[model samples]
Target chain A: MIDQLIEAIIQKKSPIVVGLDPRFNQIPQAIKEKCLAEYGETLEAVAAAIKIFNRGIIDAVADEVPAVKPQVAFYEQYGLPGMAAYLDACQYAASKGLVVIADVKRGDIGSTSKAYAKAHLGQVQVGNKNYQGFPADFATINPYLGDDCMKEFEAEIVQEDKGIFILVKTSNPTSGQLQDLVMADGKHLYEKTAEIVAGWNDKICGKFGYSPVGAVVGATYPEELSALRAQMPKAMLLVPGYGAQGGGAKDVINAFDTKGLGAIVNNSRGIIFAYEKIGGDYQEAARKAVIAMKQDINDTLSSVGKQYW
Target chain B: MIDQLIEAIIQKKSPIVVGLDPRFNQIPQAIKEKCLAEYGETLEAVAAAIKIFNRGIIDAVADEVPAVKPQVAFYEQYGLPGMAAYLDACQYAASKGLVVIADVKRGDIGSTSKAYAKAHLGQVQVGNKNYQGFPADFATINPYLGDDCMKEFEAEIVQEDKGIFILVKTSNPTSGQLQDLVMADGKHLYEKTAEIVAGWNDKICGKFGYSPVGAVVGATYPEELSALRAQMPKAMLLVPGYGAQGGGAKDVINAFDTKGLGAIVNNSRGIIFAYEKIGGDYQEAARKAVIAMKQDINDTLSSVGKQYW
Candidate 1:
């Protein structure tokens, strides 16, 4: 899955992954009304509308990006029906030949963590049958519980050729409150996390000089992004906090390696809700938005003499 | 919800919440065969079998415990059918007057965090209707993302009288990797988190003098538990790692106040899979296990002269 994502990035000439993080306000009124009329104003109706909204954006950008990350929280907000929509979006995006990153930042202890790993990236067995639940090629994980908690996920996903982006430095305003804490050895908490990710990558280097084990380096912090990029050279970064969250192309470009292929910047609301700002068909606007983002990122990569494609 | 949970704790004379974390190997052979015969050994069969298994345990221990913590990862491993079992267990447990604490350690940033808060502890609005997702009285949250990520959950759940338990000092063997890190200001990371939880409690103090905001302080580290209990006096403690994970009754007792009303201990495998250790019907073994746990904890509380009931 990691090699495939890297290949898609080179072929598309864009290190970009669209984030399918739909909220009620982001969905077009027309789409909502259409689904509401069909299913009424219930969780079922709202979830149906979200699925429609996700499919439109996915269809619009499938040809231009490497992957699409569906934040589970958005779909989970609507309950079972909402989760049904989440599963549908993941399947539809993968069917479009794009890698699906289930952005479920799940982590826990041993046996419990294995359950999460099996649900998202591996297989669960019942008698002679194996079931794939929300089969995203990769998933995001929170590493707060330490290496023991992560070992299960590594055995389940990375060992199976799938991947995971462990949360190192998140993009939120107050993330520094915990992630920036200094350890006994003088490295910041996130730096320690990056070091662990880098060491893990050494165990599973891929054909592209990278590893399926990745690190989530928030693009909002350019200094940290640059420092982390140097710290974990082989890690494919899943960069978030771009566009709507105040991370710009200039800020995220620091995450790219000398080869310009080490990171995938994700823009959720900036692309999915582009229709509101662009005043055109949502799908076309989404497509145009992806192209514009691609151009913006490519311009940076080219300026830095790192544009491989 | 904080006051309600306390009241239930006193009425039941037990500050114990049974952990409904089931695995495939834990289910009785008879139950598995019956469900597999009916549903063909598919995910459906395993999930149905789990639902039945959960209901039996819930019925057995409902009179002895204040709540039941169903770790979502177990049900999630089976996919949608497993999730259906999870929801069924939560609903059935709640119907029996037990506070259903959904042990989904979920956390993210800003709007994403709000979506999670609304899904587990609050309601989602769709046009003129509001629908409850999981409807757990409380949910566990990961605080590694820091205060901004936690505020949304506080506003959504605390304001509505529901509650959340923020991870502070986890009981895992390697939890100290990040949690015990010394900050520049000299406080440990978990201690810093405890201070924040305590401050949040000041804003939403319930009738019982505790806030709806709570902390997850693992029982395995009795010294840390004692220190954190003092640091967050107005906050309730959801102490995991009690029986199965090497935390004994003596270790968890420190999480309680002088009145023995500030904490609830959880024992998953020690109770749910008790049949494996004792030769009896699974439900009977589970009931006996709960009774013994309640007795063990009560004795410890009584010896300390902190028995509120």
Candidate 2:
């Protein structure tokens, strides 16, 4: 799956992963007006409109980008109906040959963690009933519970060919307060976490020279991004904090290897809700944002003496 | 709400919070048979059986405990219908006058966090339509995204007079690998987080001397719990890792003050699924587990010269 994802990114020559974090307030006014007119403001109707909006964006960008990262919180805010829509969207993206990275950040302990892994990553069979998992190519996970909790996930990755991006250094401002704490060994917590991430990935390296175990190192910390990248050479990097979170192409360039095959830059607000920021027709605004981001990343990589795949 | 929760715990002289993590496979044979006879194995029927089982447990132990913490993952694994049952269980437990602490470790950035907070903690005002929040008296939150992510929840807590317990030191074995990382400033990451938790609660101190902002300091880390308690004197501690997770009553004693009004020990599998461990009638096994847990906590507190209420 990691190899497929890397190949798609290389073939498309795009690092931008449109973040599907839709907010009702951020939807273009025209689209919102049309959606409200078509389907009243009931939760179900609004969620349907959200799905329509997301589908349109995915269709517009599918041929030009490698993947679409859907932030689960926005859809979950609408409850179960919303989650159903989210699942549908994942299927929709996968049907278009796009990698669907479910940004859930789920973490728990032991059997519970296994349940979550089975629920989201692999097929779950109980008696005569069998349910398909979330159908995501990869998922973002919280590593706060420690490596032992991750064992179930690691095992599933091997058995099911799934991938996991463990949160190391986050993009938020306050992340430094804790993730940047110095360890007794004189390394930052995130640095130590990066070392562990590299170690974990060593056990799961795939055919593409990259591992299914990845690290979520924030694009917000460019300097740390380079350092962490150097440390976890074999690990893929899921770089969040781009665009809306104030990170730019230059900041994320170091996150990738020289081949431009090791990183995926995520921009939730910057891409999905671009019409809100730029104020234009919804589809056109979204298309323009995706093109511009793709070019920006390509140019940045090129300048760093790395060919854009 | 913290004050109310503490007062309730002290008045009941029980620190045990019954954890509602119902696994269909692990359910007693009799309960399974009853469910099969009464309802089918479809999600709706299964959820109904789960609700009945949870209601029975709540009925048996409502008078012997302060709260019931339901892990959302267990219910969420069953999808929409299961979520509906979870909501039903929450409403039922609250109607029994038990503080419902939803163990949904949700966390995200800014506005998304606000939506999640609204979904679980604050009310949802859909245009002219009115709806209460999940109606839980309190909720457990994930603080991995940083303090800013918690601001919206803080506002909701102040407005609704509810409470939130932030994950500071989790009980999982691997938690120490990141949480216990020492900083250049000499404070461990969790300790720094404890200081922030204390700051967040300073203005919201309740009449009984506790604050709305609480810390989840795992009982497994007894020494860390004592240290965190010394730092966040005014914050309530929601201790997990009791019973099944390997923490005992004596281990969590440091989380409370001499008044025995500061901590609520959570035992999910240990109480609700006690028949698996104790081997007796389902209800009787659960009742005995609760009684034994309460006695153990009371003895621990009393031995330390702390009055239970």
Candidate 3:
């Protein structure tokens, strides 16, 4: 899965992943009004609007970016209708020849984690047949539950050739409240988690020396980001906090290796709702945002003397 | 909500909560075959069977136990149909006058956490009206992302008079991998988490002096359970790892206050699937199992000189 993602990055000459974190307010007013007129300003109406808006964004940016990450929370806020929209978004992204990364930071005990793995990445068994719940090539996971919790994903990732990015250092301001605590071993909690990721990746590396297991290192913390990149050399970094979260291109560029292919920066509001700031058709604005982000990241990579390895 | 839960516990004279962690394979052969025949062995069939099984358990034990903790993973494994079953089971249990605690263990950043909280305990607004997703009195939360992650839940919990049990010391074997680490302040990670939980609960305590915010302390760790009980005196403890997870009556008693209150022990497989060990109808076996568990826990509490506070 990591190899395939890297190949897509190399082919597109872009390491940007458009985050589809669509909120009710972020959807174009015209679309919202149309859906509400049809469905009577209900959860159903909001969800329908989200699905259509997401399809437009995916269609406009699929050829420019390698993947689209649908933050599950936005859709999940509306309930079953919202989740239905989330599933449709994933399917449509996949249909557009783009990787779908479900940003569902789910974690639990071993048995429960297995259920979540099946729900997001793997297949769920019903009678003699298997069904994909929310089909995604990669899903984000939380690692607070320890190794046993992740064993479920390890088994499925190996079986299905899927991938997971474990949360190491999140982009949120208060993430350091726990993640940055100094451990007894003199490593920050995030560094210890990074080491754990490195160890897990040792068993699942692909021919390109990248692993299906990855780590989420925030773009907001450049010093920690550089250190984590060195610590987990084979782990692909899903760098969030870019653009809208106040992380600049220079800060995120350090997350990559000399090859500039190790990190994929995620920009949600900055790209998906760019029309709100730039004033244009939302889909076209999203496309333009993606192109600008790609150029900015590429320029940073080149200035740092990095190339595709 | 916590006061109501405690009063119910005192009235029922049982601090045990039945854990509805039903697996598809655990469904009775008769029930499974019937559902499969009717629904053609699809996800809908499995989910329908699960709802019926959960309703039976809830009906059989509602008088004996004060609450039901439905581990969401079991229902989630079957996909949308499973989630629909989960919501039905919760509603059915609530209708039976039992407190429903949805054991979701969900955590994320502030904005994302709000969606999860609304999805479980509170209600989500569409346009004109509000809707509850998987309505429950309380939902379990993971506090790995720190206070900001829980702030969203805290606000909603206060407004809705709902409750939450934050994961402090989980029952799983490898939980210590991150949870038990010693922090720079010389406090173990769980202890730090307990302090944080205590601080959060101060503003939410009810007239009975118990807070709606609670801690999940594994019954398996008796010493830690005792220490945590002392640490967060005002917080209710949801003690898992009882029975099937290897925590016996004596081990779990430490989680209770001198009043034999402030803690609710959860037993899933041991009670729900008791028919496997003792031959009889599944629901009857479950009822008998619940009665036996109640007797055992009461005997233990009496031996320790505890009474209703």
Candidate 1 per-residue C-alpha lDDT over A37-101 given as tens digits, one digit per residue, 9 for 90 to 100: 99998988988898899998988899999899999999888888988899999899989999999
- Per-residue alpha-carbon lDDT of model 2 for A24-108, expressed as tens digits? 6666666667766776665666577778888988988898888988887777667655677788888899999999888878787
Angstrom error of the Cα, residue A250, model 1: value is 0.8
Off-target runs (Cα >4 Å) in candidate 2 are A29-41, A277-280, B33-45, B132-135
Off by over 4 Å in 3: none
Worst 10 residues of 3 chain A by lDDT: A73-82
**In terms of TM-score, which candidate is stronger, 1 or 3?**
1
> For residues B228-307, could you state the per-residue lDDT of candidate 3 as single tens digits?
99999999999999888899999998898887788999999999999999979999999999999988888988998985
For each candidate, give the TM-score of chain B: 0.98, 0.96, 0.98
- Give lDDT tens digits, candidate 1, residues B1-309: 888999999999989999999897789999999999999969889888999999999999999898999999998888888888988998999999999899999989888999999988888888888898888999999988888878898777656779999999898888887788787777888998898798898888888888888999999899999999999999999999988899888999999999888999999999999999997999999999999999999999999998898
Best by lDDT: 1
Model 2 scores a C-alpha lDDT of 0.81
* TM-scores vs. true structure, each candidate: 0.98, 0.94, 0.97
True contacts kept of each: 0.75, 0.34, 0.54
Each candidate's root-mean-square deviation in Å? 1.2, 2.2, 1.4
lDDT of 2 at A171: 88
Give the RMSD in angstroms, all C-alphas superposed, for model 1: 1.2
